[model samples]
Target: MGKDNVTVLCNCATDEMVKDEALMDIVTTRKVIEFMEELCEREGYPKEVLTDNGAQFKSKEMEKYLSERSIDHKRVLKGKWEEEAWKERKGKCDDEAWKERKGKCEEEAWKERKGNCEEEAWKKRKGKCEEEAWKKRKGKCEEEAWKERKGKCDDEAWKERKGKCEEEAWKERKGNCEEEAWKKRKGKCEEEAWKERKGKCDDEAWKERKGKCDDEALKERKGNCEEEAWKERKGKCDDEAWKERKGKCDEEAWKERKGKCDEEAWKERKGKCK
Candidate 1:
């Protein structure tokens, strides 16, 4: 790919490269920011980012975006990118050669060192090593067996303890439940008894009050009827006595006037005869 279209990100510590071919379409400050964001989200944000002084990387917006996230942005000096690239290639080559030399040297040194001591030590220590190995194997087996037995004992003890605890807990819960039930039943029975006694008392009091009220009402009604009847009889008797006195007075006045007229006529007849 052309250098103009390709963008490369490298880890300074690992010398690992991440090349973005997507920048071939169009590279702008916005696109650069978006790629950085996506990269950071996928991997992680870098402490420092070194890029060549391209317009997209040098823009104020790009600087602001990097600064806001606390990422240090470094612009490569003129010709520094190419120089660094050359140095990196040369360093890699030198490192590979050095590693090859070092590996050969280490292998030769180890072979010489081992050749001097390994055979004699092996001959001398073979029996000792076997004895030590046997002891270690025996110890390991015994340890495993002891651990197994201890584990079984611990498990059985734990089960027994757990069962006892559960039984005690169950018995406590049952006792508590029974006590609560008994208290509730007793309270309910007492409440019902009180209610029944109260109801009977209330009924008896109501009946007595009702009977007294009925008697008072009947007496009041009877007294009122007797008073009205007495008043009616007294009024009728007064009216009959007044009417009889008026009739007798009128008859006596008429008889007195008739007797005076007859006496005057008899005096006139005696005068005529003379």
Candidate 2:
């Protein structure tokens, strides 16, 4: 590395190459010294370093830093070929070359050639413009011719429109027919359903009436049993004994009358002496 601002630094060894590297912006002598100190602190010091006679490397601060760390610094003068080549090629872009090229043609002759070229270009452009105008007029005439032909075909157009209207009307009638059929089918289904429900209601009514008849028959049987028990007591005991056993008979009668007679009627009967 010569006397230049180094952005990147690297180290090459037998075991590792470029493993220990440092990067900096505009590497000055102070920055380079700081990096070296940090590197030595982290990875131990390097034995020797070789560099060119660059300004950053040959500075007094750089020398002091290396000496403090006991690092051997070698300096060599490096020649730059790119700078020399640029200096040699700098003389080729001179004012004399541009002056000779500018003075090659006379002013009057150049203006005459430019005017002739413009006149020829205008003639070609005018011919093309006239041709394009004629083509536009021809297109308009063809469009008018097509309109005249279409006017002669009005009879066929009327027939096509009439056919479409008839087809639409037919489709509407078919839809109405299907709708009527569906409504009739739905009404029949409803009627059958109502008949089934009526049959079930009649059966329920008959069952309810039959249950009431059975209850009446049970009450009649209980009355007959009470009559029979009275007859047996009359045949077995006297009038006084029959009167004494009447209270127990009343209790049995009350049990049989439950759910059969009205509440007020049963209460009145219970309060009677008989």
Candidate 3:
């Protein structure tokens, strides 16, 4: 806070980060942390946070509170932007160097644009005293109490920053929504495929039962049918044999009657002749 003339203020819990100015984005972890801390300390915790990784910065107390609530925290990424590290390092030029370096790694990975004005301004304000740069000027800024007089001109910065901030935030939220939809659709498709496969397998199993079966079952049915046919044939043969036996008895009785009649006739004729 020394050379930075840093101001620490809280944001509203239900505040919408507006983007009316330009494509302004949250460029530092410290900014995000402060924003969240302000909300948490003021109003309440959210059930789900849809933001960039550094957008919802965490402190120990905040983390513990979020953990207790079992709130879902999703990270939304830009092409490569809203980097926190570089801002921390550049934001607080007179702050701790190690933290500044560590924080700038992500920013360095993604820097693509170059502007002469911005580059010169950042380099000039980086590690040098503003007094040194203004040495040639006749009129001077009052250096007596710098802390009490600095906040009067920060609104222009916020205005210029609004649009990009809104743009980055929207991208994050959209990405999260798309990811959820994709996952849900994927799960539903898998479930449908599984059901279709199960139905097909069940149909094939039923067809197999209607076609090929155990030979032993067929053999049992055939044995019962053959046994019944054999009994019917045996009964018919027995009835024909009984009729033939009755006819043979009738023929023998006829022969015996014929022999007895012939003997009586011969005896009568011999008596008449004598």
Residues 107-137, candidate 2, lDDT per residue (tens digit)? Answer: 4457677777777777777777777777777
Cα error, residue 138 of model 1, in Å, equals: 27
Give TM-scores for every candidate, taking all chains together and pairing residue i with residue i.
0.32, 0.24, 0.22
How much lDDT does each candidate structure score?
A: 0.75, 0.64, 0.56
Q: Residue 56, candidate 2: how far off, in angstroms? A: 86
Clashing pairs in model 1, backbone N/Cα/C closer than 3 A? none
In order of listing, the candidates' clash counts read 0, 1, 10
Cα RMSD (angstroms) for every candidate in the order listed: 30.2, 33.4, 48.8
Q: List the residue pairs that clash in candidate 3.
A: 22-163, 22-164, 23-163, 23-164, 24-163, 24-164, 24-165, 25-165, 85-103, 85-104
Candidate 3 lDDT, tens digit per residue, 1-274?
2222322222221124433112236435455545655655565555565444343344555456457766555444553223443353455565556566766864564452345556777887763655565662423445523433555445556765776788777888888888889888987897888789878877888677655564546776787778777778877877787778777777777777777677677778778878
lDDT of 3 at 255: 71
Model 1 stretches with alpha carbons more than 4 Å out:
1-19, 22-24, 38-43, 96-121, 126-274
Q: What TM-score does candidate 1 reach?
A: 0.32
